[model samples]
Target: MTVSIWQSNLPPLREVDFLIVGAGLVGCTAAYFAAQAGRQVVITDALDVALGASSRNAGFMISSVDVYYHHAIAKYGHDVTREIWHLAKRSQALWYEFINRAGGTVKFQRTGSLLLAESEAEAEDLAQAADAMLADDLNIIHHKTDPLKRGYFAAIEQPDDGAVQPFELVHAIRQQSGVSVIPNNELYHITQHDDKFVTAYTRMFIFKARQVLLCTNAYSPRLHPYFINKVVPTRAQCLVTEPLVAPVLNTCGYSDYGYMYYRMTFDNRLLIGGGRKQNIALENDTTEDRVTDPVQQVLDNYLKRHFPDVTVPVSRRWAGIMGFTPDSLPLVGVLPDMPDVGFAVGFTGHGLSLGAGTAERAVNMMLHGTHPGALDAKRLEPAV
Candidate 1:
């Protein structure tokens, strides 16, 4: 099956220099940057624009390594871990630039982030992590004692952390000229032909371009068979509560390291997500918006225990899929052994913060054949 804009009777190809797959954060940002370079670009997605993790996430643009600096140093070495932290900081800066340029009602907030430790041992670990980051001159402040009236043991406030409305930002990027967006376009296969890449889709059209950038995230497994094992798709459940009078959570909060996370929106609605580890096996597959009873119960209990005074009704509950690589880092670089193919996926639930920068790196690599300094390609290289 071949899917092309012109061949499918949708719209003319218009001689695009780049054909980017998946109109989520990565694809849309890639299109914006590619088009900014005065290169004609076409972006397509399997579902509606911003329908994937790009829109389905809690919108936390946290500026920290996947694993804390202390843990990362112990696991991957000091030099590599420091490099990772630098990359994350650079990514955070790029996100601000993106939001400023897009200039939409994207609801970007730099309210910072809080990392709470649920237990004594975890508190010590978190303290060590904070100390490690501080030693490196990072602005992570530690509150040794529990600050919340409800007793969250230890916490670290990351001053540079922030949030953004992913959907609005992606839509704003799409409005840029020279970028053609094709929704409901699914890529099924890719073939190389005389210095160009032709993407065939199950929807019966063929797209030919000088290069194809795969930014499908978890959904990439279906198009690239090898990704099935390399990138594991996991389902995350989240719920939004009805507006509350006073904002209870001032900053985005995450506990148990990266396991459970929640944030308060401008409307005072609490958006909570995580706990896929409870049913890890079941959650490790592709699925639609199905919320598990146990997961919902856990989230409800957390809210009740933490915010006893606030009475907010549960307005909506939903599930989103995120991709996770074995190393718990994003995969951002040219696909090994494939020509003119680049990708930015496997964000491991941290796409909102790093998506734009990674996509920009992928676009730069595709255009100039060199990895951008902002992206730590060495750290994200395929383990195999």
Candidate 2:
């Protein structure tokens, strides 16, 4: 968010109540919650609304974090894992409400999701994950073999998950939030003058805000030094084929231990993403949202190997930046020196799965002084 001295000299200092940085899905949701809390909210973004990962995702509203169920338990502990799953559930519900409130303008489908395994080892992992999920009565089906007959090893089906039009969903939320938006405004710096107000310097205007919440996600590290190591920006690429004669997949299909994901669009196009496992060096720790040949080649080979019937040409290819946290979970807390500035970030590529609920919690924590608990940034603190 580098701004030259000439560009940095904004017109005037604007006073805004509950200023939200970033106008993606989480930012819009934060605005909605803040407005609901009886505050005059204004959202500003570095780019246009929903122009980032929110618009570029496959739009799967799958529950849970980036990892598999039992794997999350091993990494974050059983209680924390359960809490995050509930958070995802809450996020999906919020999205449903937004979709319903849109009066059929937003495209959505209850297509569910299939977490498939590409190898025998992954199959065993899926079995274990299914056992843990079933023990908790999480309403999922465990298939001992590939149900899709797509040459996969095993699968775990989450009946509650769904797909959506990501870009339209953000617009719906923004309209429902009924807040003013300042697009193309990048926040370069933020300073809390006192407990009453925080001043933010942006490309457009210097804002004297009552409270500030950052939904910047992958761009968070660039905004403040506190997020330097906390959020690693990773690039994810995807390609969608032309509309097929018939729909190939009815559900979001995730395989290769969650590295690969594919789903059929509402218009009958096959969208495939995730080759980062094969090209980790090129894909990880970068904010550059441009598809490369290596990753695209992997996706191409995958399509050939799996969905051999799909002969349509590739329609479009794109990339999106995802904020990957050290623990593969979202971070919700205030900055160390600026208590008036709060942030909800680091979704680890599961922004659609957890953004709304995390934003709701972030707004509550910022405005009402409620604790975010497991989602708190304190969880990342080093042991003394």
| RMSD in Å for all candidates | 3.2, 1.6
Candidate 2 lDDT over 289-373, as tens digits, reads 8999999999999999999999999999999999999988899999989988999999999998999999999999998899997
What digit string (tens of lDDT, one per residue) describes model 1 on residues 87-167?
Answer: 677678877776787775677889899888878998999999989988988888999876675667889999889877778
Off by more than 4 A, model 1:
1-15, 176-178, 202-204, 372-384
- How many clashing residue pairs, candidate 2? 0
lDDT of each: 0.76, 0.92
Q: After superposition on all CA atoms, how large is the RMSD of candidate 1?
A: 3.2
Residue-level lDDT for 15 in candidate 2: 96
Model 2 ranges off by over 4 Å: 1-10
- Provide TM-scores for the models: 0.90, 0.97
RMSD of 2: 1.6
